[model samples]
Target: MTESHPHPLFAHGTLLDPQVQAALFGRTVPTTPASLTGHTAGPLEIADGSRNLRREFGGTVEGAVLHLTERELAAADAHAGDDFARRRVLLGSGEPAWAHLDARPLRPAARIVIVGDSIAYGRCDPQGGWAAHLAAAHIASNETGHRVFNLAIPGSTLADVAAQTPPLLAPRHPDTLVVAAGINDSAELLAAPDTTRDNLSHLADRLTPLAATALRHNARMVVVGPAWLDETRLDDYEGLRFTTARALALRAALRAWCEDNHIDFIDLWEPLRDRPHLFVDGVHPTPDGHKELFRHLST
Candidate 1:
C-alpha cells in the first residue's frame, strides 16, 4: 500500500495545508472521516488576571484533535522543520496526539503564566508573535522546562488582568507570572492625563495586591513595561500633549517600581520608539517590530 493511502491523519497550524504538509513529509495523507471527541470550543476563560478574548458572540469556539496518517506525519515533520520541535502526548483515552512546538522549552514541568494584551495574543501573525517566539525559545532550550499559557486579549487593560488572574493561576499553579500592559494605558492617559494618572495609580495599587497573591502561592512575578511613543506628533493634540508627557513619566514610574519589585521589564519603547515603521499607527508594533522584541527578549 502507498503511504498516502494510509490511515487518516490530522494536521494543525501551518501543517493544515495539504501542499505544505506534502512538501514537508514528501508524501500525502488522506483525510479520514474520524472526529475528535471532547471537542467543544467555548470561550476559555481562567482566573489568572488574564485578558479576555474576542469570542464569537453567542457562538461556541470549538477545537478538534485530528488523527494523522503515517504519510501525513512524515509530511508534517518536514513542514515543521527544525524550528518547530514536535511532541507526542497521550490523551485521556490513550490516543496519541502530536504537537509541533518550538525548539525551546521555557519551563518543562513548571507552568508559566503570561498575562497581557493583544501583543500576547499574536494579534496579526498566526505563526509569529513575541509570545509564540518566546514559547519556541523555551521549548528549544529546555532551560526552565516549563509550559506557557499566554492569556493575552485584545483591547484589555491592566484592570482586566487583575480581575481574571486569580482563577487562571489557580488551576495551573504557575511558577512564573509575566505581565504586559501600558500601550492601552498610554492612549488612555493621552486622552486625559489627570484621569489617566488616577487610573494608573489604581492599577499600581492593584499590582501590589496581585503580586502578594501570586507570591503567596510561590509564583515569581514579572512586568513588561510599556514602550515609548513617538512624541513628535504631540503637537497634533495640544490638549493631550501634557497627557502624553505625563504618560512618559508614568512609564518611568512603572520602571522604577519594576526595579524595586524585582519584576522582569521587557520594554519595547527604546528599541522601536523613534522607528515610525515599527508601529502600525501610534500604537501596536509591526511584524518586524514584534520580531525585534522577541529577539530582544530572547537575548
Candidate 2:
C-alpha cells in the first residue's frame, strides 16, 4: 500500500485479534507495533452486552498500526460500531493514524426516550433538533445498540409532557428518559415580571409527578433546561413573549428540582447564552445550535 493512499489505523484491543481481523477484512493486513500516549484502555460495556476497551486519559495504550485500503477503512468503521468514534491521532512513532476511542462515556447500550417541546422536536433546524442530531450520531456510529426516541411536541408545556409520558412509557420503557421543556411555560413572563417566580414554582410542582413516573419505571432520568433566547426576536412569535430573564429563572428552577430529585440536569441556558447566531427565531435553535446541544449531551 502506498503511504498516501492507504490509511493507518491504531488497534489497541479487539482489532488486534487475528480472528476478528480476518472476519472484518477477509484477510489479515500488514501491521507494525505502535503505542499511543496519553491514554489508558479499560474494559467498558458495549452493545449486545459485550465488553470493549475504552480509552481514558493519563497513560499509554500499546497497540499496532494496521495499513488498510479505503474499503478496509470503511469496514473498520462498521466494525468499531457505536462504542467508539474514529479520530486521527499522532502515534508514538510520530505518524498520524486513525484510532477508535470511546464515543461517549462507556456504558451499556440503552434506549433513551426524549420528551419535551419544539426544541426537543427539532423546530427551526432543517436537520431536526438536538434529539435528531443525537439519533443520527447513534445511527452513523453503529457502535452501540443505543436507540433515541424523540417525543417532543411543538408547543408542549410541563403538563402536556406529564400527560403524554405514561402512555408512551408503556410501550418504550426506555432505559433513560430525557425531559426538555419549560420554554412554553415561560410565555407567562409576557404577562408580568412577578410571574417569573410563579412560573418557576409551577414548573417545580409539575415536575414532581413526572419524576415519580420515571422512578416507577426505574429509568434514569435527565432534565434539560430551556435554552437562552434572543429577546429581540420574541416579537416574531405572535402573542408569545418571554424574556431571557424568565428563561434563566425557569432553568434555575429546573436545576433545583433535579437536584432535589437526584436526577441529572442539563443546563442549556449558560452554554448557549452568548451564541446568539445559533438561534433562528429566538425560540428555536438552528442546525448548529442543535449540534451544540448534542455535543453537551454526549459529554
Candidate 3:
C-alpha cells in the first residue's frame, strides 16, 4: 500500500528523468500522466550551464504523479540539494504531493564522476579502466544516463587528490564519488606494517570533501582500494611497498575506515584474488581485469 508516505509527489524536472529517478529512489517511481497548471515551465540553468526545469506563472506543465513516503520525499530533497526546493502541491489525483522546484541545475542523468589514480584513467589497460567500462555498460543499458569523466592523475597520492580535486568538483555536486587511491600512498608513503595503517588514517580528513558532497546530496562515497599486484614486479615498482603484503595491509586499513565511517568500500583483492593473469604489469588491470572489476561494480 506504500503507506509509509501518505502524500504523493508531482515531478516535472529531473525527477521525471529516468536516470535521476533511479538514482534518488534506488529505482524509478511508478508515475502516471498528470500535471500542474497556473505555472509556466521554465528552463533552469545548472552551474554547468545545463538546464533543469522551473515553474513560472503562465501555463501548464505536464509531469507525473509519484506516491511516496516521507522518507522518500526527504531523500529527494537531499538529492536535489539547495538548488532545488519542494513545495506542497495538489496532484491530478487530488492527493497532496511535493513539487520539487529548481533553484539550480544538476548533473544530467548518466554522468558518473570518477576520482582515482591511473587505474581510473586507464593506465596499462588501453581499453580504459573499470570506470570507463562502467560508463559504457550503463550507456547501452536502459540506464542510458551513464557518462563518465575520469579525474585521475597518473601519479597522484591520497593527499594530492584530497587537496586538489574537491574544489573543482564542488560546483558539479556529484552523487557518487569512486575513489581508487592507496597504491601511490602505499608505495611511496609506507615503510612498515604499522606505518601502512598510520599513513591510511592520516589521509582520512583529506577525503572529507567527497564525503561532505555525498552527504549533502544524500549520495554515496565508494572507495576502491588497491588491487592485488604481481609480486614478481617488485623491482619494477621502484622498490616501493607495492609488495603483496603491504598492499593487503593497506586494503584492510582502508576497508576498516570506510566501515567505521559508514561508506561503501570495494575490495579488488577478492574479485581478482585468484586471477593474477588479469594484471598487465603486475599493478594495473588489463581489459579482462577491467571487465571483472565491472562485474563487481554492477553487482
Candidate 4:
C-alpha cells in the first residue's frame, strides 16, 4: 500500500502573517497551531540581506500548519522566492507537511556575470531583461559585496559569447558565469537543420576552453537554453524564421553539452511556451516575460 499525506504547509515566518497570506493567496488559508520537532529555527541571512528561518538539529520550531490546495502550494513556492527551498517534513503532530528552508549557504558575497543574446539584453522591455531584474532585486536588497554584470549583446550567437567572455576574467572575475544564448542559433534551423546542429557542436567545442578556464578559477558556469518562439509571429520579424521544434532541439543539445561538461543548465523553453502574453515580438520577452525569466533563473 502507498502512503497518503495531507497537503499541509508548515509556516514559521512570513507565511504565518495574515496580511502576507492574504497578499499571496488572495485570502487567508485555514491554519492550525503546530510545531516541528527535532529542529530549531534561527536567523539566516540571504542574498538580499533579509533574514529567514534556518534550521538546526536538537530543538523544536513553533509554527502553524496551513491547509492549501495544490495551486496554493505553488503560490507559496513563488512567495518563498529563491531564498528558500521547499521540502517535506513531519510535524510534531505526526503529519507530513511542506516547509521552506534557506537555500543559500553562508559565504562571502560573489560576482555573477551574464552573457547572451537579445533576450538576456532585455530587449522590448522597458525594465530591461531578466538580467536587469535580477540586478535590481539584488540592488534593492542592498546585498553588499555581491554584483551582477550583464554583458549580453543583441543578435549574439554562442560564438559571440565566446569572444565577449575572456576580457572580463582578468579585471572582473566572476564567481558565477551565466551563458544565456542559443535562440539565434535556431534561426537557421528551418532552412538548414544540419548546419544548425553543426553550429551547436562547434559552439560547444569553442566554449569548452572558456568553461575550463572558469572552472580552474573556482568559478561556477551556468548555461541557459532558448525560450519557445511563437511560430505565427516568427516570420514577421525581417523574414527570420524560427520554430518551437528547432528551439527544442537546440535546447536539448545545449543541455547535453552542459551535462557532458558538468555544468548547470536552465531550460526556458517549457516555462515560456504557454505564456504568449509575456512576449512582445514572439522572440523578445516583454517586461512580464523578463520577470518570469528572472523567477526561473533565481530559483
Candidate 5:
C-alpha cells in the first residue's frame, strides 16, 4: 500500500507578507483561509554588498506552508506571473518527509540550503516559494536528512557576503551556496561610480577566496545570475541608455566571472527576457519569476 502524501509547502521572504498573499492568491474566503502559526517572524538581513534603502529592509517576515487545491494554486500562479520564482511541496513542519518536490526525489532526511538576496527570499506572495520548489525537485527518497534553508536578504550585496562569509559559512555549513546579487550593486553603482566600481572589483576579487571558504567546508557553490533590467535608476541625470548598457555589461561580466570561477551559474535573464510582468516594481522578482528560477535550477 502506498503512503498518503499531504500537500507540502515552505514559505519564506515576502510571501510571508499578508498583503502579498492578497495580491497573489486574492482574498481568501473565511472558510478557506489557511491558518498559519508556530513560526517567528523578523527582519531578514544580507551580509554583503550595498543595499537599496526604500526597496530594502524593515518588514515583518515569516515562514509557512500552505495546503491548497490545484485550482487555487493555478490562480495563485497566474497572479504570480511567469517571471516569478517557482514553488514546491515540502513538509510544513520543516521536517523532512517522503515526497517528490520539484520532480526531484527528496529522501525523508536530506539537508539542503539556498542563499541569495530578496528575490531568493520570495519578496511578495504567500506560501513559501521557489526555494521550496527547488528543494522538492532535488530531494530524493534515498537522500534522507534533506533540508532547505533560504538565507536571502532584501538589500544584501556581494560586499555583505564578502565580509560575512566566515560566519555565514561557519554555523550550518550548508551543502550548497547560491549567491544571487547585482540589484543592490546596480543602485549602489549609480550612487558612487568610482567607489562602486572599486567595491565591486573587490567583490569579484574575493569570489575566489569566498569559494575557497565554501570549498574548505565541502560545500558546492552555485552563483545565480542577476536578471536583466529594462529599467535603470542612475545618478547625475544619466540617460537610460547609458545605465542600461552599463548594467547589461555588468551582467555579462559577472556571468563571465562566475564561469571562470567554476561556480554553477543559473542564467535567469535568458528564460525571463520576454516576461516583464514577473517583476514586482521594475525590480524584485515576482513569485512567478522566483518559481521560474526554481524550475530552471531543477532542470
Candidate 6:
C-alpha cells in the first residue's frame, strides 16, 4: 500500500483569523494546535508588518493544523495574497501539510516563473508587459495566488529557455514553470522542419525533470506554444516570426510533447492565427492582444 499523507494545511498566518477563513473557504476549517520544527514565525518588524517564518537551526514554532480539501487549499492560496509563499513541509508530528509562510523577503508571492521571449514579455507595452498583466489578473482572480516571475528576455530562444530555466527553477521550486517560448527557435536560420522538431523534443527533455519535481510537490507545469504572426507585416527588423507552415509545425511539435507528458499546453497559434489586428508590429502583440492572450491563459 502507498503511504498516505494527511489532507491538512499548516496555517501560520492570517488564515488563522476566523473571519478571513470563513470568507475564503466558505467555512472556517477545523483546526488543531501544531508546530513546525527548524523555523520561527515572526511579525518581523517590517513593511506591511505581516508575519514571516524565518528558518533557524534547531528551532520550533507553534501554529494550527487545519483539515482542508484540495479545493480549499487552492482557495486558501488565493486568499493569502502575494505576500505569503506556500510550500510542502513536515509538521512536528511528522505529518506533511502545505505551509503558508511569509515570502516577502525572498518572494513577492507563490511563484509562477514564466520562461519566454518578447511576445510574452509584452514588447509593445511601455508598461511592464503581458506577463505583468497576466500576473496581476491571476492574483486578482484568486486562482492560485501566485505571481508571475517573467524571465522573458526580449531576444530569447527555445534553446535559451531549455538552457536557462531548469537550473533557475531547481532552486526556487515555483508552483508553475511556464515555458512560453517557441517562435524564436523557429526563426530565420533555424526554421527548418527538422530543426523545429528537434528543438521541441530537446526543450521537452530539458524541462522534464523540473516538471516532475513540480508535480511531486503538487504543482503545475505548463507549455505555451508560439503565437500566430501577422503575415502582411513580416520583416527583418528585430524579428521572431515565421511562415505559416513553419509556425504551425512548431506549434504541433510543442502541443504533441505536452500531450505526451501530460503538461498543460496553451496553444496561442490557432486562436490568433487570423487575428492580425492583435499584432502591433507583425511580431509583438498590442496590449489588447496581450489581454486576449491573458484570457486564453488563465482559463
Q: List the candidates' TM-scores in order.
A: 0.55, 0.61, 0.58, 0.61, 0.54, 0.57
Query: Model 4 segments beyond 4 Å from truth?
Result: 1-109, 189-198
User: What TM-score does candidate 2 reach?
Assistant: 0.61
Tens digit of per-residue lDDT, candidate 4, span 48-73:
23345533333577888988877778
3 against 5, candidate with superior TM-score = 3
- Give the alpha carbon lDDT tens digit for every residue of 149-262 in model 3: 678888787777777666655565444567777677777433443543445557577566656654443234567888778877665465464677767877888888776664
Number of clashing pairs, model 3?
6
Say which candidate scores most in lDDT.
2
- The per-model lDDT (C-alpha) reads 0.55, 0.72, 0.64, 0.70, 0.49, 0.66
Looking at candidate 2, the ten consecutive residues that score lowest on lDDT are 48-57
Question: What is the alpha-carbon lDDT of model 6 when measured against the actual structure?
Answer: 0.66
Per-model tally of clashing residue pairs: 36, 7, 6, 1, 48, 0
Q: Write the per-residue lDDT of candidate 5 for residues 118-175, one digit (tens) a residue.
A: 6666777464566766666555432454446677766676777656665766576464
Reference-based TM-score, model 5: 0.54
Q: What ranges in model 5 sit over 4 Å off?
A: 1-110, 139-143, 188-198, 232-243
TM-score of 6: 0.57
Residue 134 of candidate 5: its Cα lDDT?
A: 67
Candidate with the larger lDDT of 1 and 3: 3
State in Å the error of residue 134, model 2: 0.5
